[model samples]
Target: MKETAQKYKRQTASRYLPVGAQEITSKIMEAESYGVSTKHDGHFYLLSYDGKKATLTNHGGRVIDDLPLLKEATALLKGKCKTVVLAGELYLHKEGGRTRSFDMTAALDDKSTNIYFAAFDLLSLDGEQVSLDIKALDQKLNTVLSSGKSLHAVKNSFVESRKDIAALYKEIVEDDGQEGIVVRSHNGPTYKIKPLITLDAVILGYAEGQGSRAGMLKEVLVGLCVAKDEYILLTKVGNGYSEEERKNLLKELGKKKVDSGYIEVSGSNVAFTMVAPNQVVEFSCLDVFGENSKGVISKMCLSYKDGTYTANGKQPMASVISPVYVKMRTDKKPDTNDAGLSQITKIISLDINASEKLDVKKSEIVSREVYVKISKGAKMVRKFMVWKTNKEATGEYPAYVYHYTDFSAGRSEMLKKEIKVSDSKKQIEEIFAAEVLENVKKGWEKVKS
Candidate 1:
């Protein structure tokens, strides 16, 4: 089949660009309208169909063959159009209503179902390329695919202010667990805005690649070092590495390779090459999982303990799911990672307490008065006040119950009915000695086990 003269032009968005909600709102207020849509994390493609046959092409306009989704799509659009090209993302929708890129890649081998084409733009119509407006393009695409079951137009909204854009983005990303959003200017080029959550983890090992990347490092096993010379295996991150990055990582791993240690390989097709856990690499992940529904310490690490994987006496390692290798950190050391694990443990304890059917938010240790300290240990202690907005009430209230974490001991405590803001030095000391300190120590003893 012959391709259209108007090929797909990939749009790019940079983090340094002025594409935030405020900037977008300002642009819209200046008589410039923009369409905001969820940027689906999937393969970009342009589907073309003539009266006789249908073909799928990538961003470069080259025809893709033997793909089941494409074939099904061809059948869906076989007689629908004389000649038309639809631009969109090809992805696999999970049963739980999530779009996964890994599953989309697996769909290339006919190993996946529920594959979809999220059509966004109408590129061509009746074998002719036309430059219709965004709204017109959307209307045309929707009209054409009104009866189709597999293909659907991408949903978008027109926004005129920062608040509108922000609300839409939050609804799509945070509430829906989606990647992010893409904002297309009415008369200019398109721009993307997505949240990129990154973390610093120590490199534990490397997994061998297969096929075109065989013999090279396919994925790097990374972990969080909770103590000196102590590390917990997190997850193997393979995506986001370029060809040059893979080669450079191979060289670095060769220099850092140690005796094959506690590195575990979950699959037979991949081999693990153990390395010294000294190099710290930064990774980007989708979302962090915590113990409770409130998502406390959810930014620290991703959990893989869905009862499938375990380590260290059946204890699951705090891992980042769908970790994308970003870059190696030369300035940060492995020991600095302890605070994250400590925070995770603290959140876990809080979650445990929350699971006991306690109203954690309303439960506060009110202080009678504020006091200042001047001692050797005072220099090491950081104090801050947190005010939480009471949605049911008219004003914000201070969160008197504070979390004091001992990173060195890997524990935390939530003290109640102690350390009042109105308490004097003697009263504070007496309270600490009489109840607070001992209660905290006892709390740690329970949490540590």
Candidate 2:
């Protein structure tokens, strides 16, 4: 049997680099000139027209026949082209004019919602691949596209300098609903840069891997603790961990095994072996947004009220855009790290003062001043500040002493002692020693047996 015309594959952008101002500038400079387009947070699918009918296939070349969007795309593209393959993003727009990946998943079942295929490239025409220059190909795709509401040619621009690329990226992220930008060169590479939010979440368990990762840890199940012994499973992060990190994590997970428990994830009966929940991992993703779909929203442990959504009344838990595990935070404790769902939501929403430069400077200053002392028989550190009491006293000046149990967890506050000029050296030492012991005890209690 001859293969159907619907079965077509196209090359995609696979080279992913860290999305940052510096990295983007370097990539753009290497190319010397590149085209910048909005990287919509949606699936990449190919809309193919075989002279008569239109077919939609995902980036992986798998046919997607059930989506209402695909059905609509078929009707819209019918007879529009002789034989053409258009590459584009399949996305669903939210109420605030933002497009989300989860919204695309939710819109699959909703026939009323209009799905958009934002075409950016023309892979083939009339059953033959287009071998024209980049600029010519773009122009050809624009001319062939019909006046359809569902399909659109993605807006993009060509720039020669790094400053223009940086400015364009900033404008896209800030003013254009936080959607990322993709910089593509004529005969070079494609790089994507997006506004990413990082957070620390507790690892619950691991899911079994398939293919080459079989018998190894494939995905780590992570969540945020809303209350004592209560948590909401946020996402199953599969990307970002290195091979060494994966092997090390598997060994570590072996040491902290617990009973398998039921966790609710959308459209799956996934069981996880509960761990100590003491291990914290850092993750970075696009952003969090609310979902109005009942089927999609029901899977998440979020509450909706008065046209607003929150996770445990503390953070927004609509859905994390595209979460990727950055690293296993060995220095962080689940209870102490406040980079949970709610905290991340606040930072992303700009409710709390969030600045990359300021945060880095603050962290550097804190690391320099705060000294950590490991407690006896614990994987915990006790931080303390030592200073002089007075000139008359044999010791240092401002007799104020502040001690902390765990710096990353920020559990115990600084035990301060008001210094007086009349206070003796012995009195200051005694006060400091007493506070140190108390902080040490508090730190030990937080460690899981």
Candidate 3:
């Protein structure tokens, strides 16, 4: 295990600048098995399925002029991961009269020019050569690159015609982080390179269809973000999300009241409108058609960024009560859609989940308050209570018991008759208290009998 990248190493001192056209460096590099795909319909690294060795084509490559950085960039590979070649731009930094890669005026002395590795296909693995067709290799990228980093899949197909690609390209350049969108054909092989893209878009409104959208609105509202404003109804998305997801989403939107009229399907506008523009959902779509959304929408899918986790975390309190809006939507004379109990659950689920999460074991409670009273020298202070079988006439109805107890001799006295009531708790306690006061009893013993 000697500390050297290649079993063999050699570099010529002849200097060449990278600012030359795409082909000269590519031709020279390809001659040395460095530059990639000969065809430049679109730029990509032609790689075997395994990453043991790769060829970099000069589609958008401009950093390859320096020969030393190219050799140094080649050295940046990790030998243990996959035994395949990689192709990418070898960027350098220029400092103190020397041109280098990927540096500010500083770090020129250290001499670090690393390769920005952009892999396309799996060339070989476990000594198994990548003899698979481009279609199978694309499927492999989805499997391997689904989680960790593998190869970047090149765009080769289109759902939209050429018009869509130009519009999307403009949007991609505008978005600060987006590399740009790619429109590819479903049947086109991965190596078919040319892809058409439509304009990038931002969501403005979502449609939940009437009668069924405790299911879904059947369509969603989409638009483009211009310099400051979001354009109207470029398209509507209904392709993504599951049945449960659609239901959950409608439940969320119904809770929120939109202040403005949402861009909607022209003839199919239901009672729904603007909602809180708090969520930014992203979709990779292939086409942009129609002035406003038709009743129908396109077929590409999208994944919501927030997912269920958005509802699970510390959710923002509603800016206003939604029942008024709910009533407005439901009670409108023209709108026959009456939302049912199952349709609205915001105020209920939160309380239920909170109770469950905070559940505590409950047991019988003992009274802890201390009571103090003067002992009567006469004998007792009787108490009496009268109750009615009638549940409606319940207000202080026990006051009639005073008519039965005697206090005529200027002292608390006896019961007019024996008080009894099918072992009623309040009535029994009253009878015992009255008996005690007529004689003498205190504390628990006073109430026990």
What lDDT does each candidate get? 0.54, 0.56, 0.31
Lowest summed-lDDT stretch of 10 residues in model 3? 318-327
Rank list by lDDT: 2, 1, 3
- Misplaced by over 4 Å in model 3 are 1-202, 210-214, 227-233, 259-263, 266-272, 287-449
- Write candidate 3's Cα lDDT for 382-418 as tens digits: 3344433232132211221211232323343321222
Name the best candidate (by lDDT): 2
Look at candidate 2 and tell me the lDDT of residue 130. 74
Model 2, runs deviating above 4 Å: 1-11, 16-18, 59-80, 94-96, 203-275, 279-449
Off by over 4 Å in 1: 1-7, 10-31, 60-62, 65-72, 75-79, 201-449
The sequence of per-residue lDDT tens digits that candidate 1 reaches over residues 389-414 is 12112111222222222222122321
TM value for model 1: 0.44
The global Cα lDDT (0 to 1) of model 1 is 0.54
TM-score of each: 0.44, 0.49, 0.22
Q: Please provide, for model 2 over 1-449, each residue's C-alpha lDDT reduced to its tens digit, 9 standing for 90 to 100.
A: 00222233222433334356556655454665677887776766677777656767763335765655556666766666667788777777555676766555446667435777888778777777777655666677667765656676777788887678888987877777656788777677677777777878888767555578655667787777655554556777878877877777776786665542122221122334446677788888765544222211222233323323233322234456568888878788676345354654443221122211111111011111233444453234444443442222312122332223344333343232211121345654565566556555432432221
TM-score, candidate 2, is 0.49
How much is the lDDT of residue 126 in candidate 2? Answer: 77
Q: How many pairs collide in each candidate, listed in order?
A: 6, 5, 44
